[model samples]
Target: MNCYQKEDLIKMVEDAKQLTQKGKVADYIPALGEADPSTLAVAIYSGERECIYAGNIDEVFTLQSISKVLTLALALMDRGADYVFQRVGMEPTGDPFNSISKLESSVPSKPLNPMINAGALAVTDMLVGNTIEDKLERLLNFIRQLTGNDRITYNPVVAQSEFETADLNRSLCYFMRQHGIVESNVEQLINLYTKHCAIEMNCNDLAKLGFVIGNEGRDPNSDQNIIPLEIARIVKTFMVTCGMYNASGEFAIKVGIPAKSGVSGGILGSVPHGVGIGIYGPALDDKGNSIGGLRLLELIAKQSNLSIF
Candidate 1:
């Protein structure tokens, strides 16, 4: 496939940014509620070359649900998939990220994999450490290593907002505890989970970090095995199956790439041997994915034949 010229890519991004007007920034978090509705950017990292972007590429944004995929990989690296799966199932729920219906049901509702809020919360609870500080240190280290950025930090405003409005997540944690799925204190787990969801990253860092997955858990630049190949495979599978909240299936059909989206208006996509792409446009669809980001990804993947299937 021919590589797209830098100018062409820029134009595509400009065209894609127009999508932001049709969607709304996530208002659940007052911090995210203030993002420039028209802000849009795209970054593609391949081997040693970086596209380093357009529009709002430099704007710092929280990881939101995208942090789930990273934490899930860390948990798998620490506990292996078998143990992790026991705590969370591997299926898509066709439901909102914060939905409480499944938790309230009598049916044995294991989390449908570690990409959704429930599963990610469960996975975050499993990160091995005696204290929340240690866990946060370790998680931050993992994220920093993947993104190749040592300065990354969590956004306090976003974390505080999520903590304040996280009733559904708290309920989910409580439900996990009742089901014996959560091994840690419910409140503590929610605290760690919210902080993780609040970790801040821009498009360049997000794309490079996601490139680790496309590179099969190995950091292309560092040549370090950040995660076992098996663990990476499981994470990618979950990304494809349930990464975009309830719209994962439709995204897979249209974009045909393994990706994860966060309520912070970011999408992280991986195409084997092609690219690791990141897009940011805080306006969200009902499922919480950035509508413009999703559209750009679909166009790029369709044109580039990047689908894993």
Candidate 2:
């Protein structure tokens, strides 16, 4: 019933694209810095296996922090909620995603939520693999299933860039290791974390991934569930509360969809049985979310009445 065409979304895309100038590309990660700040793209994947896209739809980008949500879902499936929640809290933090101030201040010393770097690292630590290569492959295979794309994999250049500049994340890992929230070699954990974050895909692939998440872990074309229903619910709940880094509260008020954003200017939105949206805009707000992508979602939510609230 919800078959959107490219013509239907072009206006919204163009309008949102103008905001690209208001934001800058994330430059701290050297490879991420190489992106063109003006590029903006989107794809909407419906339950019917239909897709509508606009802008630079072929551009491939790293998942960046967006991988956190997928990894969180995978972690929850591998380890039950009881086990996952014990390591990371459900509360959202007012601090930036990379900030470790809250970890030091909290009585029990755990990351506030899995959306943050510290918590993501802890969740990645829970992935069951005998070796680092196996762990990365497990995650990659899971992602390929989610997107229905057999060729999906990480960008080694981006992964290595992140690994080389992961001092802050390394520090967080060391601190968590001391607190027992993360029990593993810090170097190996960081390597795995970077690899997952560097997973690359275009807007179509991202939309497919989001569709699976929003569709309650069932693939659009499959009778079998890929992710458990309960696990999907928990992941969407976390997206609503903590997905947009420190800007989640404002984003929820405006868009009202469960969404997760990455520093690469990619946003994965699930409208809860409605549609899954993938957006890419290399220009990012101060909080590291895509400026054009956020505006585009706001427009789509308003026009389509897609808010869960």
Candidate 3:
């Protein structure tokens, strides 16, 4: 249950950075396309005295799909498991995170899981708010509380960029609306979704948040409960199964821990009762995960035997 020394972490970060050159930065989102693919960073927090950091650990990036884990946790806290499960199923879709085909083909039209874009949208729609602004604020505040960082906020430019190029997401929302799955206003819900996805944080912030989850929803530093233990377990399970888009299985085999990745090249991982690891590598593999980030996790897992499996 020991954590890596700071020197070891720095060496691993340097090694992982080598893989960044082999991957491509996400270009689908115009804002994300501008990210420097060579930038690589990682932070590890043990929820105690040890905090290891390396590379551009202070570099901020949008949460992208990584925010789905937060929104899902908040939705569970707000609506409970039974009500939330009614909207999104527990199984993996096997399709890409943004694929619309599964929504069209699945019987009863429910999203296969909350980690996917459709399911995340459905979960976002379920957030209780009189307006989209209220919902976004509430979610942002929740993230701040979880990470103990009040300065965390969304990147407006990234939000606007995603909104402009979100025809596919818009189509998914409307289709769900037609099927009676999403009852909220499509535009407002989409805006909220984009806002959460654009929420920005550095690797250290991610480690702080993941540390809470690793400690079973309690802020180990303050010894306060941020989320109920049962709910935290549920969210972590989803991360282990569906967090890395279609590549979740491979990631599980390689890293053997619960993790969520964002297109902005962020990955949040919780090693149950152990450590919280956050990584940023703008370059992506075919499965849309941070290429160098995944390599880094695999290296840590192998060297440290960090995997729960």
Clashes of each: 0, 0, 0
Error of 3 at 201 (Å): 0.6
**What C-alpha lDDT values do all the predictions have?**
0.82, 0.92, 0.91
lDDT at 172 for candidate 1? Answer: 87
Model 3 stretches astray by more than 4 angstroms = 1-4
lDDT (10s digit) by residue, model 2, range 62-151: 999999998899889888999999999999998899999999999799999999999999999999899999988999999999888999
Off by over 4 Å in 1: 1-4
- Per-residue alpha-carbon lDDT of candidate 3 for residues 1-309, written as tens digits (9 for 90 to 100): 345377787888889889898899889999999999999898888876655788888899999999999999999999999999987899998899999998888898888999999999999998988999999999999999888889999999999999988999999999999998899988888889999999999999998899899889999777989989999999999999999999999889989999999999999999999888889999999889999999999988898899989
lDDT: worst 10-residue window of model 1:
1-10
> Highest lDDT, which number?
2
C-alpha TM-score for every candidate: 0.95, 0.98, 0.97
Runs of candidate 2 exceeding 4 Å displacement: 1-5
lDDT of 3: 0.91
Superposed Cα deviation of residue 208, candidate 1 (Å): 0.5
1 versus 2: better lDDT goes to: 2
